[model samples]
Target chain A: MIINHPLLGPRDAQEFTYLGDASLISRPDAQDDNAAEKFHDYLYLRDNPAGLHRELWFHESGDRSWLVVTRNTVTHEITDVQLARDVARKEGRSK
Target chain B: MRYSGFKVIKEALTGHKGWTPQWRDPEPQSHYDFVIIGGGGHGLATAYYLAKEFGESRIAVLEKGWIGGGNVGRNTTIIRSNYLLDGNEPFYEFSLKLWEGLEQDFNYNAMVSQRGILNLVHTDAQRDAARRRGNAMILNGSDAELLDVEGVRKLYPFLNFDNARFPIKGGLLHRRGGTVRHDAVAWGYARGADMRGVDIIQNCEVTGFKIEDGTCLGVETTRGYIGAGKVGVSVAGSSSRVMEKAGMRLPMESHVLQAFVSEGLKPVLPGVITYGAGHFYCSQSDKGGLVFGGDIDGYNSYAQRGNMPVIEDVAEGGISLIPALGRVRLLRAWGGIMDMSMDGSPIIDKTHIDGLYFNGGWCYGGFKATPAAGWCFAHLLKTDTPHDTATAYRFDRFRTGHMIDEKGQGAQPNLH
Candidate 1:
C-alpha cells in the first residue's frame, strides 16, 4: 500500500481512488442559513477515524493529483502525503 | 439442548456429559430493555428478533469480540437475491426468506445451505446486467435462472470455459442462493438470544455513547455504564467508530474486505460462483474449503488485515474463473471491516439520537443481510416503524436524494 505521492514519488496504493474523509475538502457554505443543514452535514457526515486518518486519495493510476493521505486506520501507518490541491490551499480551501 | 439423534446417541453413551455452553455468558446489566451493540450476525440477530419476534423483554447482546467475532466470521459465505434495486430487491428478498427458516427458527444447526448462486455472465454488457439481475430476481419474489452457455457448462464443468479472456457467456442462477455456517450464524444468533432471555455480553468494549440531551441514554462499555432503554447499533466495521461515541457522523467507509480459504480439496465448488469479469466470489466449504472473496482494500481501513494487491487481485479473479484455482493451496486469509455505504445499500435507520438505533451499512453485504438484518432490526427496535422489508433502509437516504444506488456506483464508498 505504498502511497508516498506528493507528486508521485512512491505511488501504488493500488493506483489510488478512495475519496473519504479529508473532511471532504471542507465543503459547506451552500449559501448557509443552515443551508439545508449545512448541505446535510456536508453530504452525510464522516470522521470515521480509528487513529490518524485524513484520507481522500485519487491518483487514479498516477499524476492526476488529489492525494492527502495521513493514514493509520489502526496501523496502516502512512503518516503524511499532501497535494489534495495542496491540502486545499493550506486549509483555507481556496476557490 | 434439543439437538438430537436421540441426543447424539445419548451423548455417545455418556462420556459427553450433557453438553451445553452454547450461550449464556451474561454479566453486563445495569439496565437493558434492549442494548444490542454487535455480537455480529446483526448483533446476534437483533437479540434474536428482540426476544423471539418482538416480545422484547430486557434483552442485551453487547460483545466487542466473541460471538463469531465480526462480519459474522468474515464473509465469502455467499447467499443471494440477485438484486437489481428497488432499494435492494425487497431487502434481499427478505434476507432470502430469512435464509429459509433459519434452522427451523433458530433451533440452531445454522447450516442453512440452499446450495445455489451463479452470476458468471461475461459481457454483452454482462449479459444485459445478468438479464436485469434475473428479472429483478423474478420480480422480487426471488428465484431466478437465466443460465445458458450450456447452462454454465452443466454446473461448472471446470470453468475457464474457453477463456479467450472472460468467455463464459451466461449465468445468473440463484435457486434460493447459498452458503451459511459462517460461525454457525454466530452460534445460531447466540443460541437464539440465549433461549430468549437474551443478554449475551462477552468481552464487551463499546467505549462511549450514553448521551443525554440529544437523547441516547446508554452504552460506554469496556464493562460499565450500561443503561439503555433502547440503544441497538449492530456494529459492522464499527459503524463509523460506533457512531462517533454519539456525536454521530456516518455515511460510512471502513473498507478492508479480504477473505479466502482453500487447502482442503476434492468436492470442487458446485454452488456459488460469481466473477462476471472481476472481483471474484466462490464457495465450496462444507470442509472442502475453496471459500473466497475479492475487491475492497481500495484504501480506508479499520484494518482487519489485507493488502497484497488485494491478494493479487483476488488471485487474478480466481485464476480468471476457475482455471482450477491455480491448483489450490492458499488455506487462509482474513479481513472484514466493510461498513461501506453512501449507497451500496444498508442503513436500517433512526438515529437522531432519541434512544438511538442504527443497524449499519452492510456493504460487501453483511453476511447476506443476516436474517433480514435481524428481522428488520427487530422491526426497528420494536415498532418505531420501518420493517415493510426495511422501507429503503432510511437514515434520511443521503438527505432524501434517496440513494439506494445498488451499484450504480455514485457517492462512491470505494465504488460501492
Candidate 2:
C-alpha cells in the first residue's frame, strides 16, 4: 500500500474514520497539507508517542515547504500532518 | 534661546563635518532565540510581533542589504482592503486595522493617509465584478461604496470623460484604504522591535542553514554559525535560494516590479486610483508627485531595474485617466524583485523540516499586509498551528483541492 513521503514521517498521510468537514484528519493518498484531504476530513488513527508511524505530504501550493505528514503504515492512509515541522522532536531525531 | 539654537546647529554641523562618521556595524550575537532571514518590513515587523506576543525578546532580523533595501522600500506604498478573494480579504482587512493604529503602536509618524482608493471599471464585466466585490465587503463588515459614472466623475472631475479608449466608467470606492510612508514603516518596526530587545542585524547575509538529520538547528551566515531554537524565513525574493539550501524547490517565480514618479505639481489626485482595463494604477504622493506603476518586467530576473515598456504602459494609462498629466515630466523610477507564487497569496506556516518556518510569496499587497502577516506568522511559530485566515494558505492546500486561487488564472501568472 502507499505510504507517507519518505522524508516526512507516516503522519502526513494517515487513514481516519470518516469525520465531517470539521475533522482535521488527512487521507492516505491525497496530497494536501491542510488535512482537508482525509476521507470526509476526519481523524482516523491517533498518534502515540509510544510507536513510530509513516506519513506522506504533498506540497501542492508550490511554496517549496514540505508538509510533515504522519500515517499508519499498515492501513496505508493519512491521519495527521505537521507541515514544515519534523516528526520527532530535536532530541528524538538525534538518537 | 538663540544661542542655544546656534549651539545645537554648530554641534550638528561639527558632527557632520568630522570625517563623515561611519555607521556602526551590528555586533554578531552569540545566539538568538529566533533568527529572521530578511530585514524588510515583514522581517522587522515579525521580530516586533514575536517580542510582543511571545515575550521572547531575544530575536534577530538579519539582512544582506540595509533595512528597507528590498521590496519594503521599493513598493508604491498603496494601502487598501479592496481584495475580492477569500484568502486575501480577512488578512488585508486586519492590516487596514493595524495601519489605522500604527502611529500609536509604533510611536512613529508613518503619514498614513486614508484618503480612500478607487478602482475604475471600464467594462461591463469589470463593473459587475466590482459590484460583487463591494457587496462581499459589506457582508464581511468592511466598508465599500459602489459609485456610478456620475458619482465617479463627481469624485474625480479631472478623469477623461469622453476618451474613446475604455472611457471612464464607475468604480469601486474603498474609503478606508490609502497610502503610508514606506520607509518609515520599515524604520518604525525596526525601532519598535529594537526597543523590545530584538537585534536588527544588517549587512549580515545568511550563507546557509545548519541542518542535520532532516532538522534545522540554526543558520550559517557570513559572520559564522549561530545556534537557534527556531528560524523564520521571511526572505521574500530570495525564498527559492533559501529553501534550496534546505534541499527544497518552491514553485515560485522571481519577477521585477517597477514603480515610477513624475515631476512634483500642485495637489491633483486626492486618492489612489487604478485602471482595471489598462493594468495601471497611481497615487499622487504627499509631495505632489504622481507615484505609479504596473506589472513586472514579465521575466524571471533578480535585477531591480526595469525597461521603458512598463514606464510607457503606466504613463499611457495615467494619461488616459487624466489627459493633463501628459505634459508632466517623469522624475524618478525604480524596481524591486517580487517572489510571485503559483497562487497570489502568501505562505506562512511551518515547513516539513523541524524548527523551520516561512512567510513569503506576498505579491504586490505585502506592504500593507505587513502587520497582519507578522502577527499571524508569530502565532503560527509560537503555537504550531495556523491562524484563522492563514489556515487556507498552507503549503498542502493545493493538492487537496483547497487552493485559494483568488485571481483564478490557475497555475502561474505568466502561464495563466
Candidate 3:
C-alpha cells in the first residue's frame, strides 16, 4: 500500500507504522467525574467503520513525523492526508 | 443417508446416484427461537450444539454469504492447545478435545489429522519461555514436549539450525495438535445442524437489530425482518460493523491476514512448523501443497486483501526457517480479515442489550477455537451465564482490570 503523505508526496506504507484510529488523539480527560468509565471506553472501544476511516500512521522510517491518513477501509484508497500536529490544532488539542 | 462403508459400496454399485445434498437451502423464516449471525464454522457449530446438545429448536444460522465462504475456509488449518495463560490454556485445550471427536460427533469426514505442531525456539530466552509454556500446557491437561536441537533435527533435518542470526536452539511440540480440513469443518457442522432441524439460511445479511426498549427483539436483514427470541453474533472481522447497527462499538479493530498455498509436491512437511523469531507458520495439506501464513497487516481494513510488505515478510520468515521453501512456487494466496481485540483474546458474553449475545475478537486464531467457541456460545445464549471454560471472555474484562493479554502487549490490537 502507498500512502500519499502530505509532506513527502507518495511513500510506501512500510515506511510508516500504523497506530490505528485518529480519534485516539483526543484521549479522554483524566479529571472527569466518570474518568474511569470514560477512559475505558476511550481505550477499548472503537468506531471500526467498514467504509472511509481516518487513522494515524507514524513515519518511523522517514521524517519521524505523524500523519492522519483518511483512507477507505473497503478499498484501501487514500482520500486525504494531513500532519497530525495540524490535525491536533484543528481539533483544539494543540496550541 | 448415513455415510459408511456399506453406503459407499451401495452408492458405487448404483453409479453414485443416491447421494443427496448435505444441507438444505431453506427460505428465511419470520421467526426463530435463536438466530445466529454468520454461517461460518463457529455459527454452524453453535447451532448444531444448541439443537443436538442443548435441546433447543427453531435455531437458524443466518449467513450473508454461503457457509464456509469466510475465515473458516481461509485459515492455515492448524489446531493446537499450547497456550500459556491460565485464562487461555483451558479454553483452547477444551477446543482441542472437542476437535478430537468432532468428525465422529458430526458424522462427517473432516480429515482431522493429528500430525503435530512444532514451534521452534531460536534463543536461550525463547527456550526458557517455551519450557514455561510447555509446563503450563501440561498443567492444563494438554500435551506438550520440549525438544532440544538434536531432537528437532531428528524430526526435520533440513532446518537452518546453524544460521548465524537465528539458530534453532530447541522447540515445543504439541503431539495432539495438527491440521483439519478447513472447509469440511463448516460443511460437517452445517449438515449436522440441518439434520437436527436447525435452519441454515445463507444470503441473508443482517442490516440492523430490532432492539425495543433495550431488548433485542430480532434483526432487520436484507431478506426482511426476522424475529428471534435471542440473537447471537459470531461474524469474525465483520463484528464491529454488525454490532454498530445495534449501536455498539467494539473493543476491536479489523486487519487482514493473508494465507498462501504452494504447488503440490511430494510429502515434504511432516507436520506444522512455526518460526520462533518471526510470525510465520506452515503446514502441508493433504494434497501436498504447503499452506502457510504470517502476521496481519498492521492497520484497520475491511478489505479482504493484504499488501505486499506482509507477504514479503512472511516469505522472508519461511525462507529463514526452511530454506527449501524458497524453491517451492506459490500457487495461490488469499486474505481473511480478523477482529483483533485489545487483549489479543476473544470475547464471548452477553451485551448490554437484553437477548443480544456476542462472540468475536478471535484475532487470527478463531479457527483453532471453533468447537469450544460454539459450545460456550451455545451455553451462554441458553443459560444467560458464561460457560465454565469461558468465564474470562467477558466484555467487562477490559473495564474491570482483567484483560487476558497472552502476548503482554497491552491494548494494542495490531501488535497482539
Candidate 4:
C-alpha cells in the first residue's frame, strides 16, 4: 500500500503508523454530565464499515504528520488524502 | 446413519457404495426457534449443542457462503489454553476439555492431536511471566509445566539458544494443547446438527435485522425474511457490520491476519511452538506442510488479503527462530478477518435488543475456542443467561472498567 503524502509524493505504507478510524479525533468532553457514557462510546465503539473508510495514518518515518486517508476497506483503493490538522481545524467546534 | 467400525467394514466390503452426503442443503424455513447467523465452526457447533445438549430443536445456521469457508478454515489450527488471567484461563480450559471429547461426541474424525504446545521464554522477565501463566493454567484445571533450557532442548534440539539478542532462557509447556482438523470441525458439527433436525442453510446472507420496539424479531436475508424466537450472531470478522443492522456498534476493529504453509516435508515439528520475543508460531499439519503465522497486518481492513511487508516480517521471524525454515519454499499464503477487541478479549453476551445475542471479538484465537464458544453461546441462547465459564465476557465489563485484558494492552485493538 502506498500513501500519497500531500507534501512528500507517494510513500510506502510501511513508513507510516496506523491509528485506526479518523473519528477518534472527535473525543468526548470529559467534564460532561454523561462523560462516562460518552467516553465509553468514544473509546470502545467503532463503525468498522466494509466499504469506504476514513482512517488516520501517521507518516512516522518521513514528515511525522497525520493524514486522514479515505480508502475502500474492501478493495483497498485510496480515493482521497488530506492533512488531519486541516480537517480538524476546518471542523473546529469541540464537544 | 450412525458411523461405526462395523459400518466402515461393511462399506469397505461392499465397495463403499452406500455413502451419503455429510450435511443436507435445506431451504430456509419461515421461522425457527433459534436462528444462528454465520455457518462457521462456532455457529454449527452452537446448533449442534442446542439440539443435543440443550434439548432445543428448530435451529437454523445461516451461512453467506458455504460452511468451512470462513476463519474456521483459514486459521493456523492451533489449540491451547495456556492463559494467565482469571477471566480467560477457565474459559479456554473448558474449550480444551470440550476439544478432548469432540470427535466421539460429534461422530466424526477431527484428528484432535494433543501433541502439546511450547511457549519459548527469552528474557528473564518473560520467563517470570510464563511461570505465572503456567501456574494460572494449572489452577484453572488445565495442565501446565515450566521447562528449563535443557528440558526444552530435549523436546526439540534445533532452537537458537546462543542468539545474543533473543536467547532462549526457559519455556512453558501445555501438555493437552495441540491442533485439530479445522475444516473437518465445521463439517462434523454441521453433520451432527443436521442429523438432529437443524436446518443448515448456505448462500443465505443476513442483510438487516427486523427489529420492533427494541426487540429483534428476525433477520432480513438474501433468501428472505426468516423469523426467529431468538437471534444469535456469531459472525467472526463481520461482527461490527452484522450488529450494525441492529443499530449496535461493537468494541472491535476488523483487521487482516495472514497465515502461510510451506511445501510438504517430513514431520519436523512435533507440536506447536511460539516465540516469546517475536510474533511467530509454527506447527506441522497432518499433510506435512509447515503451517505458521505471525501478527495481524496492524490496520483496519475488511479485505481478506494482506500487504507484503507482513509476509516478509513473518518469514524473517520464522528464519530467525528456526534457520532451517529458510530453505523451505512457501506454497500458499492466505488472510482472514479478525475482530480484534479492546483489551484483547472476546465478548459473548446479550445485546440491549431483546431476543438478540452476540458472540464475537475473538481476536486471533477463536479457532481454539470453537467448542466451548458454541457450548456457552448455545447455553446463553437457550437459558437467556451466560454459561458459567463465560460469565466474565459481558458487554458491561468494558463499561464497568473490568475488561479482561490478558495481554495487558489497554483498549488497543492492534497491539493485542
Q: Can you tell me the DockQ of model 1?
A: 0.29
lDDT of 4 by residue, B86-162 (tens): 88999999999999999999999999999999999998898888888888888999998999999999998998887
Interface DockQ of candidate 2: 0.02
DockQ of prediction 4: 0.88
Ranking by lDDT: 3, 4, 1, 2
Off by over 4 Å in 2: A1-95, B1-25
lDDT of 4 at B375: 97
The 10 consecutive residues of candidate 3 chain B with the worst lDDT sum are: B1-10
Candidate 1: docking tier: acceptable
Across residues B215-236, which tens digit of lDDT does each residue of candidate 2 receive?
Answer: 8899998878877878999988
Deviation in Å, model 1, residue A16 alpha carbon: 2.5
Fraction of native Cα contacts reproduced by each candidate: 0.77, 0.00, 0.91, 0.91
Q: Candidate 1 on B1-416: residue-level lDDT in tens?
A: 76857888989899898998877776887998778888888888888887888788688888776777778878877777777877778888888888888888787787878899888888788888888878877887888888889988988888887789678888888888888888888888788778878889889889998687888878888888898888888887888887887877888778888888988888867788888889888888888988888888866788799889889989988988887789788989988888887778888878887879998888888888888888888888888888887887888878878888877877778766
Local accuracy of candidate 3 as per-residue lDDT tens digits, B1-416: 66888999999999999999999999989999999999999999999999988999899999998999999999999899999998899999999999999988999999999999999999999999999999999999999999999999999999889999999999999999999999999999999999999999999999999999999999999999999999999999999999999999999999998999999999988999999999999999999999999999889998999898999999999999999989999999899999999999999999999999999999999999999999999999999998889999999999999999999999998898
At residue B369, candidate 2 shows an lDDT of 87
In candidate 1, which residue pairs get closer than 3 Å at backbone N, Cα or C atoms, i.e. clash? Answer: B148-B151
- Residue pairs clashing in model 3 are none
* Candidate 3 segments exceeding 4 Å error: none
When 2 and 4 are scored with DockQ, the better candidate is 4
DockQ comparison, 1 vs 2, better candidate: 1
Query: Which of 1 and 3 is the better model by lDDT?
Result: 3
Task: Show the lowest summed lDDT stretch of 10 residues, model 1 chain B.
Answer: B407-416
Better of 1 and 3 by DockQ: 3
